[model samples]
Target chain A: MGQFILFLVLMTLGYLFGHYAEKKHYKSINKREKELLKLPVISCKNPIGNDTVAHVKLSYGSVVISVDYFKRILASLYNFFGGNIRSYETLLDRARREAILRLKESTTDADQIINLRIETSSIYKGNGNSIGSVEVLAYGTAIYFEKNEPT
Target chain B: MLMSNIEIIPNKTIVTGFGVVSGSTVRAKHAGRDLMAGLKNIFGGELKGYTELLEESREEAIKRMISQAEQMGANAIVNVRFSTSSVAAGAAEIYVYGTAVTVE
Candidate 1:
C-alpha cells in the first residue's frame, strides 16, 4: 500500500512538471520560429548577389532535451506493447527548432545563410529504462555581404 | 583576423594563404546543475543548464582559434568549421578550425 501511494505521488508530480515544461518550451520555440520566418535560413550553398565582401564562418545551435517521468511511464508501456513511443517525437522536434533558433541568433549580421545542415544524435541514449537526452545540432556557413563597394 | 565559413569573400584581394588554424576545449557540467537537472528530469524539457555549458565552451574554442590566426599575422580566417565530441561522462569538447589568409 505504501509503495502504491509513492507511485501515485511520483506520477502526479511528474505529470504536472512535465506538462509545464513542455508548454513553456513550445511557447518559446513558437515565438522565435515566428520571427525566424522573416529571415529565412536556406541551404542553397550560394547566394544570388556578388560585388560584396563575404566571410565563410561556422554558426551552430544545439539543444539537449529529455522526456519527463510521466511520459516515460507511457513510453515504456508502449514499448512493452510493441508500438510507437510517441513521447519522444516532440522531444526531437523541440531540440531541432531550438537549434535552428540558436543558429539564427548567432548570424544576425549576415544577409543570407547558405549551406545549412542539421545533425541529430543521442547524447545519453537512455540506459534502457527511459529516453535520456538527445542533442540536435544545426550548423551553417554564414556569408555577410559588404554594403560598400571597394574602389 | 576576419573569419568566415563562406568559400570566398567578394571585393578583397587574397594576398597569401597561411593555411588552417584550429582550437579546441573540453568542459564539464557542474555538480549543482547535474543535481538540479535530475530533479527537473521528472518534468523534463529543455536542459538550459547543459545548453549554456556547451555554448560557453564552444565560444571559448572559437576565440582560441581566432587568436591563433592573429598570431600568424593573417587578416582573415575563412572556411571555418566546428565539431563537438563527448570525451567523458558529463563533459563535451568543442573544436573550431579555419583557414588564415592575408586580404588586401
Candidate 2:
C-alpha cells in the first residue's frame, strides 16, 4: 500500500512539473511573436507598364495541431480508461481559428485574396499528457482591381 | 502556338509579386522527449527531432504563402520555394516564397 501511494505522489509531481514547463515555453513563444509583429510590414511592389500592383505578405505562427495518428490511439486508450476526447477537438479548432485571424490582418484588402494556400506541421514533440505542437500558416496577395475589369 | 496562363515560361516573364508566410512553435515536453530520444539513438533510433519540427513549420509557411498570393489577385503562383534557418538549437524558422502573377 505504501509503494502504491509513493507511486501516486511521484506521478502527481511529474504532471505538475510537465504542466509548468509547458506553460513557460508557451509564454516565451508568445513574447517572440509580439516582437515579430512589431517589425515593419514588408510587401512587394510589381511594376506593370503604367500600373503598379501592390502585394501583401501575412504570416501566422506557432499553432498547435492534433496528430491524427496519435490522437486515434490516444482516444481509444483514454476511452478504455474512461476519459473523453472532445477536449482534443476543441483545442485544435481554437488554434486553427486564431491562426486564420492573424493571417487576415496581414493584408489590407480581404477581397483580393486568391490562389490561397494552407500549410500545417508539428513544431514540438512532447511526452505523456503533453504531445506536440502544430503550426498553421495562411497567406495571399492584396490587389486593387479596376471596376468592371474583365479577366 | 496557344498560350495558357498556367504554363511555366522561363526567362520571358518577370515575377510581378512575391510573398512569404511562416508559423512556428516550440514546446518543452517535446524538447525533453527529444533529448532522451537523441541519447537513445546512440544505440540506434530514428532522429526525428528536427524532421518533425521542420515538416510542420514548412507546411504552415506554404499555406500562408498561397493565401498571400491569392490576396494579390494572382491567378497562379510560380517559382514556389521553401527555406529554413535555425533560429536556435531546438528552434527553427520555416519560410515559403513564391512569385504571384496575373497572367494574360
Candidate 3:
C-alpha cells in the first residue's frame, strides 16, 4: 500500500510538471523556427561558386535537455510492449533544433552554412530504471561572402 | 593547420591526402556539476555546466586530432566529423576524425 501511494504521487507530480515543460518548450521552438526561416543550413559537398575571398569559420551549438519523469515511465511501459518508444523523440528533436537555432543565431555575417554535422549523447543516471537526460551538438562551417568589386 | 568538415576547402588547394586521423576522449560528470545541473533542470533551461564539459571534451579531441595531423606533415584536415556515445552511466565519449591533407 505504501509503494502504491508513492507511485501515484510520482506519477501525479510528473504529469503536471512534464506537461508544463513540454508545452513551453514547444512554444519556444515554434517561435524560433519561424524567426529563423531565412538562414538555411545545408550539407553538400561543393560550394556553388568559386569564390575565395569569403571568410570561412566554424560555428557550434550545444544543447543539454532532460527527460521528464512522466515520459520516462510511459516510455518504459512502451519498451515492455516491444514497439517504438516515441516519448523520447520529442526530447531529442528539441535538442537538435535548439542547437541549430543557436548556431544560426550566432552567424549574422554568414551567407551560407554547409558541411553541417550533428552529434548526440544520452545522460543516463537512474538505477537501471530510466534515462535522465540528452545532449545534442550541431555544428557547421559558415561562409561569409565578401563584397565583389566591379571589374 | 586548417580543419574543415567539408570534403574540400572552398578556395584552397589540397596537395595530398595523408589518410584518416582521429582523436577521442571519455568524460564523466562530477558530483557537484551534476547536482547543480539537476537544480537547473527543474527550471527547464540550458544546463551550462554540462555544455561546458562537452565543449571542453570536444576541444581536447580536436586538438589531439590536429596534433596527429601535424605529425603526419599535413597542413589541413578535411571531411572532419564528430560523434559521441554514452560509454557508461554518467560518462560520455567524444570522437573526432578527419582526412589529413597538405594544402597550398
Candidate closest to the true structure, highest lDDT: 3
Q: Flag the better candidate by lDDT, 1 or 2.
A: 1
Q: Tell me the tens digit of each residue's lDDT in model 3 across B30-96.
A: 9999887765443344567888888899889998999999999998888888888888767889898
* TM-score for chain B in model 3: 0.94
Rank by lDDT (best first): 3, 1, 2
**What DockQ do you compute for every candidate structure?**
0.51, 0.08, 0.40
Per-residue alpha-carbon lDDT of model 3 for A50-103, expressed as tens digits? 665455666778888876666778888998887877877887888899889888
Write down the lDDT that model 2 would get. 0.44
Give the interface RMSD of candidate 1: 2.7
Counting clashing residue pairs in each candidate, in order, gives 7, 32, 0
Of the candidates shown, which would achieve the greatest DockQ relative to the real structure? 1
Please provide, for model 1 over A22-56, each residue's C-alpha lDDT reduced to its tens digit, 9 standing for 90 to 100.
89989988998887775667877566666454455
Predicted candidate 2 versus true structure: per-residue lDDT over A1-151, tens digit per residue = 9998865655454345434543454565466556445232223323123433333223332343433333434455776788667534544554554454455455434234333345554444454534344455444333333441323
DockQ, structure candidate 2: 0.08
Q: What share of the true interface contacts does candidate 3 keep?
A: 0.36
Query: For model 1, what is the error of residue B82's alpha carbon versus the real structure, in angstroms, after optimal superposition?
Result: 2.1
Native contact fraction (fnat) of model 2:
0.00
DockQ of 1: 0.51
Q: What is the TM-score of chain B alone in each candidate?
A: 0.91, 0.63, 0.94
